[model samples]
Target: MSFESEESKKLGGIKLSTLTQRLAYAGIKEQKAALSRKATDNNIKQIQAAIMLQFGKLPAPAKIWANVRHKDFTRQVRNFMWKSIHSAHRIGTFWKHIPECEDRGICQFCNEPEDLEHIVLKCRRPGQKEIWALAKELWLKKHPSWPVLSLGSILGCGLTTFRNNNGQPLVGASRLYRILISESLFMIWKIRNNSVIKREGAAVPAHEIHNKWLYAINLRLNFDRALTNHAKFGKQNSIKTPLVLQTWSSTLMEEDKLPENWIRAPRVLVGTEQQSSHHPSPPPGRRGRNR
Candidate 1:
């Protein structure tokens, strides 16, 4: 309550700007450090348990966090994954304490309290189901069968490892999984927001979801292609050409017709089987349309 400490007052009183600045900075740093000392929340504990159950190995919290921020992930994806792990999204129980808005926590289709896990993995909603189906179809092109996925696996995808017959890391395949998981997860979230906030909870059409997913994957392909330009991104920063090719290898349309380096190939599309009957067959020599 007093403006002056005896020593400070002797020096220059409490009006001493330099001392005041130092004290304020130290208090801020101490408060910041206190955040790390707080106990982990149930959301994080659940994610850790899910990771162990799905992966058969548990990672430290720091490693999981680092994996979420992998450079392969786009900025929005990194943020999404981070928020997912922290359960920072204002859904489900976040609405429970609000008097009239508690209904917002309930899924219209599932009739269950809506949470990230339900939205991304278990929702019968149009977007979640269609997005995962498209992701699986594209993934099947690379592997014999898609790995069983859970919310934990999807969130910690960067930490997921793939190995070939010789036990060496399947770098391309692993990278591809991360990209697919992060992209698909973000798309699901965006569609849910659009449906709730823009459409007043109307379900997006399945065919539109399919087309949007196709565009998303093909756009990622284009991004990978652009990153392969060593001169544009610098040799150190650019993704390797072969790695990009391997990541997308069998998934593209007309794989047999493309040149050895299809990075610059035109009109590339992921060659998944179309789920919509009305979709036209791709023109000869051009597989997936990049819309």
Candidate 2:
């Protein structure tokens, strides 16, 4: 039955069933908007100054979601990516700006300022560089022409482009790119929190970080496999499985269940000679120093 000509749906005591509720909701929304405006306008300039100094102008809204095809990543990881894009995720440098407390904003491992970029991409804390280097290597293998990563690009590279050297569109690779960057960033955030919060200054090893990365990617790859595996094999498959299989079968790996191809980023041997001048090893006795 049409409700337009009848009494509206009602709830306990509230005018939820009627146009009155709509008016109430509008009033509430307007009040919230006005309060927010008052807050920003009347507050000290520190909030704006801090944002301008560190993250710069707000990033433009993402023009695309390159991972629209992939559905295996968790809601939490996606949320982290959303925050990372605008540089809203917390880091030591952000804490240092608060007027109530004194934080030096230095990275515990590198002694450099611990900004979001440093923690997510360049942190020399036990596991960070190795994890990122592995992420970069795998990303390059799949997308050899992708530009060297910057903090901004790491967060939003999926929307940046999907092309190669000749500018031809690289259609499906964008999904893989999204996983590589977002998963790597998520792992780094975990490592950072472990060092700062849970570990209470203890270092997390590179291999441990590598293992977590492995577990995460393997989980997603397996989910993708299950999706693309046909009902003819036994169980119901996702509707998109056929479409994904058409493009995925020959590129990333040969075997249907093989995760090694997609999760191939290697773990850095903590003290290996690969740690060079630019990414120098810490002195003999320092925590997280290779060898």
Candidate 3:
């Protein structure tokens, strides 16, 4: 039985279903196009100024918006960055007008107005500090020094550039920085939300926080490795094996012991200096049994 009304289907020689689908697609396309125009808001201006202060070059507002959709970012992290740049998260003053919800706008730990910056950067939450510390330790392996991380710098991490004394671009280091910054920021926000909503403001333990951060990093490492398969992601989309190696070279567990091409290596973990000493990394294609 046909569900479409004959009159509706014949109106423009197109079925009602097809017309509805076209209209819906057009609406979605319009919304996406609006994002570029929205880039002129104060939030983007602040990010532009922050990027300029940190990198010594002002990226256009459009570039900042484009960076939020960087191909390297996972879909969830990309959306979070987009919301952050738009200041769309219901934090800080979003609850000010709600009846009897004023306290929801304040951070219980710091007793200050709550916002994305406070959650990710300024809050003294256990997870916030430990996550960043772990990220810095990992980054220090890739570069000699770490950049001064501000809210703006963190958001504009996609535009971050790394260079050697010869003024050559360090592509691996830049990619690593973007991944670490975006993941750490998202982790902090998760911890904060869990504390405020689920645990009723209880603090997560420091050790647990560190473990969570490492897990997130290792998960990304595994995802990167999976994306390197030409059969899966194709040449254009797949991350080059060398780039992956360079991105994670110094940070893997028993990195020196691992083979040169370890893309297919099993149980490849990102480990700290202390942790690396306890667990030896296996060479590529070695399937060993543990007693």
TM per candidate: 0.79, 0.56, 0.79
* Model 3 misplaced regions, further than 4 Å: 1-40, 273-291
RMSD of 1: 9.2
Candidate 2 matches the true fold with a TM-score of 0.56
Per-candidate RMSD vs. true structure? 9.2, 13.5, 12.7
> lDDT (0-100) at residue 289 of candidate 1?
26
lDDT of 2 by residue, 25-99 (tens): 877678766754553332223223332343353332223243322353467777776554334555654467577
Candidate 3 residue lDDT tens string, 6-62: 886653455555677777677667765675347437667777888888768999988
Best by lDDT: 3
Which pairs clash in model 3? none
Clashes of each: 0, 1, 0
* Model 1 C-alpha lDDT per residue in residues 1-291, reported as the tens digit of each score: 887766765432334445667776776677645542342355456657767886577788888888888988999999888777767688896688689999989987789999988999898878987687678767777876677777777887888778888879888888888899889999999989888888888987776777777788878899889999998999777999899988988888888998988888887777864457476633443532232
* Model 1 lDDT at residue 12: 29
